[model samples]
Target: MKKYSALLILGILFLILAACGSNDNSESSGGSGDSAPASNGNASSEKENQEEPAITNAIIRVAMKSEVDSLDPYQASATDTGIMMDNVFDGLFDTDENGELIPNLASDYQISEDNLTYTFTLIENATFHNGEDFTAEDVVYSYSRLAGLETGEPLSDKWAVVENVEATGDYEVKVTLKSVDSGFLARTIIAILPEGYEEQETHPIGAGPFKFVDYRPGQSLLLERNDDYYMEDKVPQAAEIEFVLMPDTQTAVLALQAGDIDIIPGVNAQQLMQLDDSVTTLSGPSNMPVIFGLNHAVEPLNDINVRKAINLAIDKDEIINTVMQGSATKIDSNFSPAMAFFYEDSVEGYYETDVEAAKELLAEAGYPDGFDLKMTVPSHATMYTDSAQIIADQLGKANINVTLDPVEWSTWLEQVYTDFNHESTIIGLTGKIDPYDVLIRFVDGYSRNFINYNNAEYNEMIEKAILETDDNERATHYKRAQEILAEDAASVFIMDPDSNTVMRDGVTGLKHYPIGKLNLEDLSITK
Candidate 1:
């Protein structure tokens, strides 16, 4: 299905380009005075044709519950931001619908036998949205900036494995790794930017199927088709795409029903139940892990017993059924099932709802009457805050007082996520196709580890996993890392939220990648 969708879009784009070329040739030939002059009737017909609308093209309006914090690909961390950037930027590689990494900007790549070095040959004639020619120097600069080669804060911990990125030739680049990282190739999905990406704070330009046209924060982001896109075959079918910010899922569903919006990236189960036959729904397991993060820096939560007590108090099954509406799967570890080789299924069912045992554990941790804990959950979705409420009630039975503090998405990202100043938070850790991308967060001193979950054993295991070249050996290390988290009750494990997209019945070509991105390049509207 994925291949078919891509190929069909390619064929359509080829036809569009061919017709454009034909028009150019005709205009050049007909403008010569050597040719016979057109009659008045012919001139009038040409004016009428100029005034006609391009009915073959489309403009798709997608709705999202929250607005993006940043449009910069390197700084974006939320699902909505990722989706927006995915359209405006072209990465070195992109995963298929099944999460297998494939070449995108790079025509082909090679890995050394020892797995310490990787070489890539760039696609010739590729140009950024600003018409700047792309070359290996741009790739080197992007990677260097991401890896903090200049001695500043890195954009993401995902770049920690890179030793250095150097351009060997105008169209060739080589990346030397500090160690053998099996997941490094997949993690190269980070979008390649122009040589200098600093000035793109307000608007970003990249070699993508679409170009940034306009953006109004808290309102809508507009993108237009990039006629000069590197992969001409991947030129967006939609002449324009408008991502409108929705206040909530209810408003979005209403818009879908009223024909105000064409699609919603994530439609909850309740919202799905409310939609009529006019809406078409598509669903799959998401790579994101919705976790109840407990800040280990806090007083009582610092104790493993308290963390275990809190973990055992809540019933994951109830949360999965009642709160999630059976649209998710219960997970005991941080790893999701979407990560085929590394996920450990047997680790589940280790902790069941046992109020008495939880009480005993809390008492043992010097919290007999249950200490108060402040939990801040992002107000992005009702599911998150509702799950926090249910968890508060469950912990209350074990005499653990949890205060629910709901904040806006921006505030949550600033306070709980960036600053790491909160006692606890309920947020989803969006995963990438690579296992290392998700596992790197739990490493000591990781910027994204806002919960301050630090364990020497966990950090060591993750490091070992990164250096291991063999697939099975790396899996063993990853499994051990998960086992350590489970044993220590690192976080209140939640479920992998199901990705449910609700679109108009005639909407087609909206591909849902397992990593929770909506591939809108090929999206089209049909009556």
Candidate 2:
């Protein structure tokens, strides 16, 4: 293992992000370098053409990558599911156009001097979709259930450090953590439902800019504007928005060209090439790590030699150029370079394409002839399936027999992500405002530890990263964790796929978030 004797110390753990690779994460984060198009420059002209440029009741049809797996805010697992949850649920905190954490249900919040306690002043007029008033009790119910204080079955460690949650007043809630954690604000962005609201599986309710209308399996999810929303400034511009499931990128591109769909979010570079001048690309910042995951619980994968051999077997540069058409940022560590707070760039080019060396490593692991491995890919996301095919061929060169198992996104979520019933898979992990959310998934016993990786040194580093107050020291701990993941070959950390959204030339109000959500609150159509 190489030592990072000369570590680049980075401060400002705050993930105030805008475009994908910009120096600053401000409102104008997306610049010409990111290939992001200029803002709604013709917005004024379009307004003159219509009495209401931002139509109050206009419908903006969107493309969903897959069927929404679950309506429950807690069940948002994939990109499409997050998209659905973004509209139906409003959390205690929300993200701005540049991905900065902002007040949502909580109008204002104060952190204690020690940073262990958080006092929030809730929005008084906020109402749920079911016409229920949102209060501090609802916050207690939602967070307590997530922390396992209410259900007696802890779903996540989102509040693991939290010692208590109490409602001091009808509109005031205070959270006291055991220790200081600067990144605690990121966890507050998930949905805060009404107290004891449990019909989320069949029907969902929240206090976002939009209300649920209907959802048809394998078809679409419909949402209408929430007229009673407390935040009038951030109200939905369109009266209705429909998320139509379109798994195939080419088909979705065609639909967009035919004016059947208003927008296609997260389109790949190849799909961008297919669109003509009628539609423009809103290329924005992204911090997702598209990984070729290997379950450590599996037989051959449990062996570190086999894992390292698999890592050396494929060429990441080839995959990026062939499948992504150089539209992605090649990442060697689990973290993306866009998140400068913890991203370790020194590990880049650590593993070169060495097929013979990979074969030798396989022989060292007692597998003279590489064993067969099945890679489960979610078919809904074209990037995963397309990259899976290329990865299979690449691994085959080192005598590793590869088979592709493409499943629906929902099935992939349950089987691969939740059930831990897969050998290997290819998927993209979205980002958050804090590095904790990204690193926690790799913890051995974490709910999302589908990879089944376990390393004592790596685990200890992460534990220290969370507890460490000094930004330099905390980032150092995180850096070591990233180095360990690369050296240990935990997974084939690929690239941060550039976020590109396709929209008609005149359509505006498209903004890219660092967290990679296709927020539709500002979307509107203009002729």
Candidate 3:
């Protein structure tokens, strides 16, 4: 076995650990970028004068990438489910148009001097979808379910640091954390539900701008404007919203062209090329990292050499240009470059395309002939399937046989993400404003750690990042954590796919969230 010298290892770490500061309000923090046509701009505008259009319905039809798995806020981890949850549930805090964390359920909050405790004052007159008065108890109940503060069976560690949540007054809730975490506020985006109603999966009740109407399995979901919503000015401009599930991107494109669907919040670059002038696109900032995740618990993938070989065999630029149609920027680390604080430019070219080198590494791992690997891809998103094909082609050059298995969104969620039942998969992980959101998933035993990645050194660095009080020191720890993943080739890091939303010409006021959500609350029709 070869041993790395301490000084040599230190030198490499120093080179990658340079200060990469982040601006609090950078686009990476969250929210959509400027609204401009992603493709042929305003080509469909000419038809606007040609027809009198139908405006009597007052309903905006949206095309979702997949059928929603569950309305239960605790169970949903995918983007499609998050989209629906965004409308049905309101978090204690949410991002503004500029990506800054602002108050939602809690009108104002005060943090302790040590940053370990948070006291929140709820808004008066806020009511739930069922007309129940929203209070501090609801906040405590919702967060308790999310953080498992009281319940032993916690949903996710996304808010694991939350020690306790108690309602001191009718409209006041105080939360105490185990430690001081800078990103804790951003994680507060979890939906606040009524107490004891946490078990409701099929039917979700929350205080938001929209109210659930009906949901048909494998078909569509309908939501209507919540007339009792406290935020009158921000209420839905459209009377109703229908989210139609389109499993295939081609089918979705056809639907958009045929005027059956008014908007597709996220359209890949390849699909963007197919749309004509009639569709308007808003190209915005997205922190979602499309990764070729490998289950470290799996046989061949358990070998670091095999992982590095797989990473080197494929060309990221080629994938970006060909599969993404030059819409995305190649990323070597988990955090996007748009995220100024923890993203390091030096890590951009960590692994280069070296098919022969990859083959040699496989030979070193006792597989000179290479081996067959199955890549489970979710069929709902074209980016996943399209990128999977291109990746399979690239790996083929190194004699690695990749069998592309396309599965439905629900199947992929249960089998691939939740169960860790596959060898490899292609998927995107949406990031939050905080660097913790991106790094915490890679922790040894995190619920969201579907890839089953476990590294002692990585875990140590993350722990330090969480506890570090100094801004520069915290960022340095985050940089080291990313370096560990890159050095180990934790996953085949891919680009942060450009967030592209396609909406018909008649749709007005549609916007995209940087955290990867379509804001329909302010949407309306001009036709």
Candidate 2 residues 261-315, lDDT tens each?
Answer: 9877666666667777777566644677778999999989998889889889888
User: Over the stretch 160-226, how does candidate 3's per-residue lDDT look in tens digits?
Assistant: 7888999999998888998887667667777889877744587788888888888898889899888
Residue by residue across 119-168, what tens digits does model 1's lDDT show? 88778878998889999999999998888877665666767668899999
Relative to the unseen true structure, what is the Cα RMSD of model 3? 8.4
Could you tell me which residue pairs clash in candidate 2?
Answer: 19-285, 20-285
Model 1, poorest ten-residue lDDT window? 23-32
Tell me, by TM-score, which candidate is best. Answer: 2
Candidate 3: where are CA atoms >4 Å away? 1-57
TM-score to true structure, per model: 0.88, 0.90, 0.88
Please, what is the whole-model Cα lDDT of each candidate in the order they appear?
Answer: 0.72, 0.74, 0.73
TM-score of 2: 0.90
Which residues of candidate 2, in runs, are more than 4 Å off?
A: 1-52
Shift in Å, residue 499, candidate 3? 1.9
